[model samples]
Target: MPKAKKKNRRKKYNYNVDRKKLNRAFRKRQAPRIKCSQIRHAWDRTKSVSQNLAEMGLAADPNKAVPIPKFMQPVMKMDIDGPEKKSKIVQKPYVLNELEYQASLPEKQSQTLSRDLIDYVQHMIQNHGENYKAMARDEKNYYQDTPKQIKSKINVYKRIYPEEYQAFCTSLQQEKMDKQ
Candidate 1:
């Protein structure tokens, strides 16, 4: 059998290839030729970055350019003082006193009862003489502008008929007064 042919090393075959220039050309090809202004217009019209990119004639797979929002934290422009270092961010404990929390929050006024209506309801509850529930139901059905007009009228009826509301304080007062 013939001996295996040795690989011929030729000086003419050696040539200097500039990797930097080749890499630069490759990067240029990868970059879009579209103008920045056109891209901006597309973004402005769509009101979104990815949506604008989609219309800008770039072959973009949304899955590639940007990851799913759920998997990613919001991008924040944090200045790096040194080399990239990550520290666990601990959330501050929510310490709230009952009074503080209540004070901080908005106050909720009674829906149907005004200050006058509340007094009227108390009076009706105290007397313990009539069916205020029916009257209340009627007022609720008939009256419109609450906390101002209708609310007061409804309370007056409640004063005449306390049983309608099932208000416990009214029942106790009626017993205390020997009206029950």
Candidate 2:
């Protein structure tokens, strides 16, 4: 029988020099042309664009170019030389009542555990009691979570459904009493 050819498993790092050169030439051709008038004398090659703009005295700060007035400017009304017209009648804005406002609001959604998750927690508690290590090792624990992770899941369940969790604990205690 003829011997099979050995496959090369090593990674090849071949740099395409021709492609790099072509890309560099293309980028140079596409470079933006800046006008002589656009170039400021106050501009520092080492400093950023904003710092250069601020140094030029063209703006106080590049970010806050437009200065905010300390007081609101009065609205100016101009009289036009045209035929006299009747004043426009203004209507009051429609206001919604409490009921209407409540109706307009979105309904609140309550987060509840899935049946499978609830059953999983119940099974873990029944099989392992408070021992998270035992729960983590349980065959029902398909996710193969650590003991800390198992404890955190149980804590989340307890926090989300405190009353239900309390009732569940009572039921477990009753089951133990019955067994005795």
What lDDT tens digits, residue by residue, belong to model 1 across residues 52-75?
444443424757545565746567
lDDT top scorer: 2
Q: lDDT score, residue 61, model 2? A: 62
Q: Residue 166 CA error for candidate 2 (Å)?
A: 1.7
Which residue pairs show collisions in model 1? 124-159, 125-170, 132-164, 133-164
For candidate 2, report its TM-score.
0.43
- Which regions of candidate 1 are displaced past 4 Å? 1-83, 86-114, 127-133, 137-180
Per-candidate total of colliding backbone pairs: 4, 0
Could you give candidate 2's per-residue lDDT for residues 2-120 as a string of tens digits? 76666456767768558888888997676534343334333356777655544444443644656575566565746688778753322211212333555689977487888889899
**Candidate 1: worst 10 consecutive residues by lDDT?**
90-99
Predict model 2's lDDT versus the native.
0.71
